[model samples]
Target: MDFLSTYKGGLLVISHDLPLLDESITSVLAVEHGTLEPFRGNYSYFLAERERRREQRIRERKHQDEKIARLEEGIRRFKGKTEKMAKRARSWETRVEKLKAQRTEISRRGRQVAVRFPQPPPSGRTPIKAQGLAKAFGQNVVFVDVDVDIDRGERMIIMGLNGAGKTTLLRILAGVEHADIGEVELGHQVSLGYYAQEHEQIRAGDSVLDHMRTVSALPDRELRSILGHFLLADKVDQDAGTLSGGEKTKLALAQVAVGAHNVLLLDEPTNNLDPQAKEALLDALEQYEGTLILVSHDTDFVEELAPDRAILMPDGATAYFDESMLDLVALA
Candidate 1:
């Protein structure tokens, strides 16, 4: 609702994007029974209040059960004209209304206890064949004819100077942009997820919780836990439009952890992250036992992540290496 409410230009006030929410929202709304209440708190408050409400419901159910048992006795022993049954029914009905309200509130509050990502069917290791790939803008040839094979579980890196068409090749492989010539054939059961530096996969105006619920089919607890890992636990109630670049990148990466896939296509995946975050990510990548295709400017990270294999491009030609990219460039 806050997203639909706009001011001037196209500036968004609130969002469900985890990263964006952490950067924005200052308040929260809570509902109890049929009454609506607003909360001026952040992520911590939201979780605590939700827990309080859950506890409240549990107590309410206990009270209702006892009341129902007592009321049944009265109904059996006393006549309807005495107003005992009517009174008990009214009281119980009101309690039932409150319990129902709690249930509704739980669902409406955007609490996903589970956070599962989509697991595209494994693209097993056979071999990805790229034959005669080429692209050009008018006469300014971006890349000339090229053929390559990506073996199973291959940790590959496309290395080239700026404007050498590394991004163009990645885009073609990711199916985001096409090539003017040649075809990329994947091995059997090849699953892929790409993380672009610009974060184009995320929509605008989504909150942290909202974003989790959008992509995840998990419960609120799980969602919060995952957001916590990305430093958004205290800011989940915040709007997404307010997050920093680093926070946004963390949030985007968190989405990938929901489900397991085969190939990870990363384009400068460490753009805005701090040194600590970058190292943590590198640790994860090192431990990851899957195929990776990374495009990065971090010389150290690239060397660490895609060592012993590099594809260097110059003009309309590409040179393959079974060693360090820096070594090849140094020789050049």
Candidate 2:
């Protein structure tokens, strides 16, 4: 945000950071219904103006609809009554046609996924424990001597800038990648659900419905219903590899929802999700009773989750979540 604020050039920024949007952006180019509408101001101003335009368009549509209704009624009453009445009705029909041609389209808001995680079975007091965990790729050391413990039903967030080993640490904990020097231990009866930022858990050539079936034993009818909630019902037969970024994210989350895992390791889960989908995910997380370890750059999401503790990356330092760390969360 600091760099963008100072640079005097046209910068196309795509971000969910409210602070950055309110402070740094001079204008907003909102893409809706396959068209770009430019608003000249900060984020707040753009929201207000957009709302005003939508309301105005809605009113116009209502008035036009009423006029069309009345015209149709006249056409029905006058047709076949008399030659003069029929001629007048034909004129009214022509007027209705012209009105319909000139009618303004009222934009509809985008649909959001209604996500709900299955109730996870009870687990031990400590869901996960990492001791002296360290990882490196060749000469680049990601983190070392890291120690962290996730208590039952606790929400923890990992904060760090890019390349600061946040994703690497999550992968290690998820058992997708190994730590060079230490280990992650799961408590008794603890099941893990991992959401990879790159969607690595989803296999190529597999249909979206097939992927859901692999993680869940729900009947086909029930599974299809859950997929419908995530807007994946129509894409059930589509190959997972061919999905768009947002579709893939939704599919991955759908898998997580049906897994009934007591511990969730989410790495940048909000990526590729639109604002509405993000809100839905946040609401679902708020109601979740299982332990959570999240790696995300969305400050609003982090604040709303109200993580009990934070794991600072690379150094592997641990600290309680506080307002002061919000800036670092943005950087992450």
> lDDT winner among the candidates?
2
Cα lDDT of model 2 by residue, 174-234, tens digit = 8889999988898999999999999997888999999998998999898899999998989
Q: Give the runs in model 2 whose Cα sits over 4 Å from its true position.
A: 13-20
> Per-residue lDDT for 284 in model 2?
92
Relative to the true structure, how large is the alpha-carbon lDDT of every model? 0.66, 0.90
Following a full C-alpha superposition, what root-mean-square deviation does model 2 have from the true structure?
2.3
Question: Residues 218-260, candidate 1, lDDT per residue (tens digit)?
Answer: 8989888888866679868767767787777877777766546
Clashing pairs in 2: none
**TM per candidate:** 0.58, 0.90
lDDT of 2 at 87: 99
The TM-score leader among the candidates is 2
Model 1: residue 73 alpha-carbon error in angstroms: 61
